[model samples]
Target: MSETFVDLGFVTAPSGVVVLGMAGWIDYWREVGEPLSVRAGVAAKAGGGYLREEECEAVAVPAAADRPLAVRATTEPSMFDEEPTIATLEIELGLPWPEGVDGPVLLGDLPVDRSGMVIGDGVGLDAWTGQEDEPADGLGDVTFWGRYEEDAHARFGGERIPHPGGVDGVYGWLDVPMAEAVALEAEISTWRGGVWGQGVAGSVEPHVDYFRFRRAGLHHPLNVGAIEVGGCQVLGIDWCQGDHSVRHHGGRDWGQAFPVTLEADGTGGTVLRWTIPPYDEDEEG
Candidate 1:
């Protein structure tokens, strides 16, 4: 079950290993640890960088091999840093809106009661490159993941990018229409935090890698997602965008959090399973 439109471009990793590439994009990925980098604050992702050859719309469904998978604002109020904070790291593979019309909603859970999150050390992640003065980089376990806005050549079919009044992304209405193509699955497990049993993500020795992005579905409301920093990593920007070139065996598994799953196979199609978990041990401390 593989769909298409072609030309993918956007991904990163470095905190433990998650990869998202933002914060100015000189290579990005820096912050390791400091108490959630100041309560999950580092204010990264202005334009979120990387994505060219302009081409959107993607899909996938191959199985086997596994592994893998944010925040914004960064400044603007002064006086020895009075009080400033802005962060956005979207990653929704279909949320609470799953009682019918399909199943499986565990991208990260915790929308209210799905309760469960832990991508290693409880997601506060550290060490891929942290604090040197702190201007960039925050959390991304396992090491670097790749993909950057090739220069924002944004172009995804075009027209229709309204919806924006708060709730930055992951908004669902499901009238159904934005699924022209964008599915690629192949992430059995590559976290090992809880050891394959604690909410989710508990396996290892399965890393051929496979992480795409920009697979947020539904156009009715169109608050869709796919940006692990601040905003606009191609969120229906150019609109009908497309760029899917997968091989199956996989080779990219860092920022699998921003929307990048590649497993190969063939079937009816229509599968969204992402209930991630694993990272307790006082968050590996």
Candidate 2:
């Protein structure tokens, strides 16, 4: 079968770079503390220092960060041979499922993925914070994640529930059908590069990292996208530029992920395929 590619849209890189990872930065600005205030052109001033929102390109909303993020939708999940752990630093993982299993891990309920806005010359999570590095060549890492819980389970965790896909009465209703081996398939095409997609890609541009910083540990899945004004991810760090924009196909309905089957393999190894869209959180409603 021909390779199926999906474009999520563009991510603005006004400073010539972008940061990708979990929503830890979002948690910092929106939840953890008050945002920084703009002191000058595209720069938010803090006690320690500031970051420049210099524009390498024009954008929408006069400064909003935006960009195109595409994905290689796949059903063929890359299997691990030795079940290697993906981290070096040990930290707590607040997962609902046990460790050791192929899971579409949801980043929402994370105990890690933390950040602060500090760094030397002012680049780090908070202060002591500076722009996190993406490959100097303008590329970041990409990988896959599956839920640590059961691959297939009814959306509501109940066996009997009518209209499992919609709000029969209220949100979190038990009527939704079970989702198995399901996930937000990714590895962006258009807007590529980042520490990780968290759940999606950012497609950051080169030299843009100077103004962008990301946190480590836990985060909401869409945190990366939230950072972009399409151009502005750091709050209070403002500038005079048009808003950046992006396009995505994450609006597909439940169990309606796009699929492309591979030629049958007789080998004993398992080959699973999945059809996925851009993971539009709007569909949850």
Candidate 3:
């Protein structure tokens, strides 16, 4: 078993305009008897392309450390679109790992909390892998099975959004050691029309390389899709949010509906089951 530590920080303009918040987690594969240490900082790159270091203040202590991660001093937002400025959170491992340890690994999912922004209501995780010092130009080597957020629901001005459901956190793990030459890739497609895997009121052709995973996990939440896993074809769906109902429309007369649940079988496997409800006639498409 491995131990993981998560670090979170935020940066904003002096006026409190949020630049970005970052959350990073590292996994320790080897057993270390001593406590681990972490240090964090921030850097800024203005629209003019000049990089500058900034002062940071810690607001919250990390899970593994007594000190807070560093945050950047707020700066003015760019006046023009072309001059977009960037604030980057910098985190470093304060102590060395034991020999034969594979990580201090960082995921591309920064887990930023940019609430109230027009960029929609959620953060997205990217699939990529590389050494901390190496450029990330190649495809990811890990299998990203899926991600979920917790406590992601938000309210604006005392009114809940039409769709208030969102995830606040994600959980995943490495299924296998990564090979340097392997790249993350996957395909996605959809089928609409006629029910029961038959009849075609509409059809969606295959989308090559539409999605990729660094590892294998239950990723898709709404519909059944097939992907090649371990050289075998597997179908999976995920409704990660609890108490949420999903409707599957197949043609005009046939459809499937269910509430999803994720269960662990206690043998390092996850079981996904759908509590399908009886068909409802009043539901609008």
Candidate 4:
């Protein structure tokens, strides 16, 4: 049989330069008994020694600070984590792989094979905070996600044309029978980089991670794909700018793909399990 596989490149690009490498002076502005504050931007002075919104950029408040109003101000360069631990995503494809194993490695920077790839509708579940990443009680598709791409040059407000051949990859969804499709409900879960503690903190661009589906059912407003098979396995990578962006596929690590597995556990229901690689956290820094 011919190979039934394809690769779709990532949608967005990644950041290249290491933010901390640049040389800049940062003044550590702190009060004796106040929460350590990291000025984000400019603010104006509202009261005594207080910079208002115009004079400063942004400020961070520690959860465990003694003084409620004690703030810090300085003209020093800020230090941020270049690679922040974003979120984790997992979804169980009910059907087994061709050899009872996982599928091929997907590079996110590759281009979607419009001819072979099917951009179907799909949904995203808010499951990170829950046991099973599924809607607690909703029967129908609750969350929906879409697939979109921003022209690299347009995003940067540049006039450079993307390299010839654009990108190359294949993506599509193959539906499992209704009985099987219904048997497999999305147990997709995702997590994002949270509050930046003293050990770690940073900001992120507004970009949605999309999973295009082939099987149609319920879809997330910002997700991609159709729910057909008993389950699904998606692929992509964290990307960075310059040559590194090409490497990451989209500031994501194409090297790893989250695999969510669901199987019958004797009683005819489903047993779900997911595997995610260990990543760096803010603590223990």
Candidate with best TM-score: 2
Candidates 2 and 3: which is better by TM-score? 2
Report clashes for each candidate as comma-separated counts: 67, 80, 15, 73
lDDT by residue (tens digit), candidate 4, 115-170? 11211111111101111223222222112111211221122221222111122211
| TM-score-better candidate, 2 vs 4 | 2
Candidate 1 lDDT over 45-141, as tens digits, reads: 2101122111111111111112222111112212222321111223221112313433222222111000111112112232222112222322111
User: Which model, 1 or 2, shows the larger TM-score?
Assistant: 2
Per-residue CA lDDT of model 3 for 152-239, tens digit only, reads: 1111011121121323222211222233312211110012222333321211111111222211222222212333322222222222
Q: Rank the candidates by lDDT, best first.
A: 2, 3, 1, 4
Q: Against the correct fold, how does model 2 do in TM-score?
A: 0.20
Worst 10 residues of 2 by lDDT: 55-64
Q: Alpha carbon lDDT of residue 69, candidate 1?
A: 25
* Ranking of candidates on TM-score, top first: 2, 4, 1, 3
Winner on lDDT between 2 and 3 is: 2
Candidate 1, residue 196: Cα displacement in angstroms equals 46
**Residue-level lDDT tens digits of model 2 in 167-198:** 23111121112121111112222222323432
What lDDT score is found at residue 186 in candidate 3?
Answer: 18
> How many clashes in candidate 2?
80
Q: How well does model 1 score by local distance difference test?
A: 0.20
Q: What TM-score would each prediction reach against the true structure?
A: 0.17, 0.20, 0.17, 0.17
Location of the lowest summed lDDT over 10 successive residues in candidate 4 = 16-25
